[model samples]
Target: MPESVSAVLGPRYRAVAVPVDGGDLHVGVWEPEDAAATGAATPTAVLTHGITASHVSWAALARALPGVRLVAPDLRGRGRSRDLPAPYGMPRHADDVAAALDHLGVRDAVAVGHSMGAFVALVLADRHPHLVRSLHLVDGGMPLLPPPGVAPQDVAAAVLGPAADRLRMTFPSRTAYREFWSDHPALGPYRDEVVTAYVDYDLVGEEPELSPATRPAALEEDIRDLVDGASVQASLQGVPARPVTWYVAPRGLMDEVPPLYPDAARERWTRELPTLRLVAVDDVNHYTVVLGAHGVRQLLPHLEADLR
Candidate 1:
């Protein structure tokens, strides 16, 4: 592998494949460089990335919380595990994460999720309550109320737009893929090695024809669940009144003024889910919420709020 996105952050990591029903799930484990040097066990945080994202996306978080061990898995169909057979959905994703935790001998962990990962995290906590101690949702997990009379597929089309459309397209080279993202409104602000590492890892195949590793069919199912899935709904309703914090960026994927959750929608959700603790971080869009420096700086304090 090329230089890791988290290399300069003083974290030591190794990737392991944990066997599941369908296939082996690739899990990357990161530990504080200091702790690894001294050979001490640390508390662990199991991270789940957004749709079409791989474990590489958590490099920022691994750097930010070096004191805690990080366990991130490339959800089936998005990374090294892309070949894993489908039946993809939020619950299936949750089951895979739970299996990863168990395989690693981690009896309990703080589940961290970003975007669609938030929904997966919630279901993980619900399905395997004993394995998850607390839930941290970044810019997602809450049920998004689709516009009145809009079908689920139409809602996904409107919300995802280019993010989903790019799945069907192919790029000529990895550099071309990077160049493609360079023009992205949300990604433009973050033109760094970390971002490059992420986008480069996303592409696969020959120079003449390379495509993003994410499968459109799998992403479609996951997005559908985000909009209207029974498992997510049940998890939202079943989770106890615990102090779960959702760190939201104030902008959308395109760096739009109003974030994914507008003022009124945010207020309504807050009232509906009284147990959630919502914090709007400034100067970040949906993609930056977990990938950028400003967002990670805001996330660290919350991640280590109550170390057990």
Candidate 2:
């Protein structure tokens, strides 16, 4: 781990490699301050990251929830778990999350997912209902309606342009990688120690040929599952009956108009899953919806309500 990340996570953060099917999954655990001081059972939340993101992506949220234990995992094919073998999809990712929770003796956790993690969280709640108490989805989880003329298989490439494209590219150094993300419209504006630590932790290998830790194959498989997979479709069927709250970002991935879940999409999902509460977070884009302060502010109320 980078020094910046250590500083950002502070002294209470620890990394645990939980054994899974193919290999071990890297899980970042942040112990709650209040719970530790009073010897109370700390509240736990399982935070799943996006398609191309790692556990570090949840640093801000972890900091915001001082009394809640945050368990974030680098799902197979991303971050320190990048080398974990294939057969990756929503089910596999959800199982990995369950394994991490089991290893830590955590149950009935508030499952919070951002982006691709939202899809995983839904599947987790559906498959391992005993493991999750409630669901908090940020900018994802609801079915993504691809634009007209785009096939289901091509939605990953069409929607995730630069995010998926960077997997194949290599940077000369970590500084170069930082410079690359500094230009991202959504992330550039909020670039700080937390974001920089995330960027730095993303790079793996020696200098002059460093590359992103996320595997293209993983992103491809996960997106396809999210779009039209049988498992994801089945998971959606139970949303109306489950305790779920989804937060929508007004901006897109690049901080552009027409966010990932527009008003029409939200309306359609709301009608279908009438029980699913939808909150529109202002000013943040897809990435910022979880990485920025605005998104965290919107999430605090829901977390307090659900965990209380």
TM-score of each: 0.94, 0.97
Tens-place lDDT digits, model 2, residues 1-308: 78988998877689999999988999999988876564546678999999999999998888888888889999999999999999999999999999999999897699999998999999999999999889999998987887679876777677787898899999998889999999999898899888888899998899899999999988877888767778889999878666899999999888988888878889999998889998888788898877777778888998878877
lDDT at residue 38 of model 2 (Cα atoms): 44
Residue 208 shift from truth in candidate 1, angstroms: 1.6
* Candidate No. with top lDDT: 2
Give the poorly placed runs of model 1, Cα more than 4 Å off.
4-11, 34-41, 147-153
Please state the error at residue 287 of candidate 2 in Å. 0.7
What lDDT tens digits, residue by residue, belong to model 1 across residues 1-308?
54544463333788889998788998899875577554435688999998879888888777777677788999988888888888899989999999999888888789999988999999998889888888899988887766567776687777777888888889987778888999998897687767777887787777879898889988887887877789998898755645578778899878887677778768887897888888888888888878888888888887888445
TM-score of 1: 0.94
Clashes of each: 0, 0
